[model samples]
Target: MPLPDPWNRDSLVWRIPLAGGAAESDDNPGVDPPEAWVRALAAVALDLRCLRYGREVNVGRLVWDLAVDSEYFVSIGWQGARGVGGFSRGEGLTVDASFGEAAVWVADTVQSELAGYDFVQWPSRGRHLLLPRLLATNPAWVDPHGGRR
Candidate 1:
């Protein structure tokens, strides 16, 4: 069978950005979602808390990027940290390294978060977030919610 979109240069397994977010259709603006290993963002699904300050960054645009490679995975948790007010700016990066990942050196927290952290280049409408790092998290730690941990 064919592999996935984020295959490493080393040619090992498969990886990709854990794409997830709100599923709003104008009726319910916000709702509490199950807390799980949601890639980079701290909050759960449909969690409007994360997109708090996104307006300041992109106003009303929804932009995203995801990258993956052998033995490592990257994610950009940009919802403006408004995703969770406890979330802060200028912290540089935040990652659950137990999963073998690292937060990139962010230039603009808002822009960086939306662009996936590695941010090699901008995606035109949005900033170029980056997820540039070789992961070291234990394989067993994956999907910690599941028996995978």
Candidate 2:
């Protein structure tokens, strides 16, 4: 069965059964990441002022959906295309550093990475303001080598 849409408040009330007949408990919180990991990621989001977008940005929610073992790298305007769906795995500027190191990297890089792209005068608001830059430089949206797609 499909998991309920996580973004839907009504859907969230439905309790989806755990795989392998596992039970949820404080000692075994199922798929949730450790509190330390969550705090680290939350610190990153806070550093970015992502809370400014409220529910429109998933990073603000401090959800643990990324693969813990994967190497992280920067992704400029990573979530610019998701619209109201907000950030998810593979979104945002990633860092290969440890959580502590990642937090510092984010703090140091966010201002520089997001510089001049604030779209202060753009009519549309929220994270969409970053979309224009994303479209121009994102290889998925443009040919970085200056070749026709």
Candidate 3:
């Protein structure tokens, strides 16, 4: 199956401008989403409070380039203290051992919470906004009132 367009016009994903007078979207070729992992790392990434330049990096446009391009498993990583962010594509579907602490933290956090979810099926519109609501209803990830540590 063709991967879902990460650049869906209606979705929140947008282009980030580079130093030149061009946009990152200019060369980006949207990938066909993997059937096994229906979730957009982008959606979960948006809720993360990680800050950049006194603001949050646009998580909606953060695509797992390695995963989408090579058909491999991918992950997001960051180090708040060091101001570092990274993406990694696993050998197959597993995470690599060389990943840094921040990468591992983000990966572990998201995976643990999404233990049984396949994000590919999430609604195309407002998927980011709805994920918190969905997680709230899941007994494994959230309490009845929808708060968790």
Candidate 4:
């Protein structure tokens, strides 16, 4: 039988192979990138001051449901390698985050950090995507194409 639907108000569903790899394979049954991704995400959660873990959740299960304030609940998971996560605020808001690559970091808000860059809607989700700059104003990201601003 097909696997049961895993999406709900409390869970995030992920696709596989990240860019192109599997969590498991028939010949090599032990390769699991999702597990590693989960570990990285959990470490990020621990370092984030904006998020607080509920009594039921600890470091071991940070990949599972997490309480985000009184009205919001968040969950993260992966099917193969494509990681998925989100932030939900009661019935009013639900932001789905998708990563083309699994190298992701979670923060309370990126508004301050991405200020002044042109942003676009990220797919159908309510979230915004920061546009890449031809000439990065920050000294650390100088563009080689001679478009410095």
| Tens digit of per-residue lDDT, candidate 1, span 1-149 | 43333323432221112244443222223532212223333221122223232233322233222223233333333223323221223231222243222222222343343444333232232332222333343211122132221
Q: What alpha-carbon RMSD in Å does predicted model 2 have with respect to the real structure?
A: 13.7
Error of 4 at 145 (Å): 30
User: How well is each residue in 1-149 modelled by candidate 4, as lDDT tens digits?
Assistant: 43223344333333232223323333324433244344434434443332222222222222232222222323333221122222322222223322211113222122122232234121111232232222222111122255332
- Steric clash count of candidate 3: 8
List per-prediction Cα lDDT, in the order shown.
Answer: 0.28, 0.31, 0.31, 0.28
TM-score list, all predictions: 0.24, 0.30, 0.28, 0.22
lDDT of 4 at 14: 38
Worst 10-residue stretch by lDDT in candidate 3? Answer: 14-23
TM-score of 2: 0.30
TM-score, model 3 to reference: 0.28
lDDT of 2 by residue, 1-149 (tens): 43323333221111111111212223223454333333444554443443233223323322223233223222212223223222322233333434554444333334333332433222123343222122232211122234223
Global CA lDDT of candidate 4, please?
A: 0.28
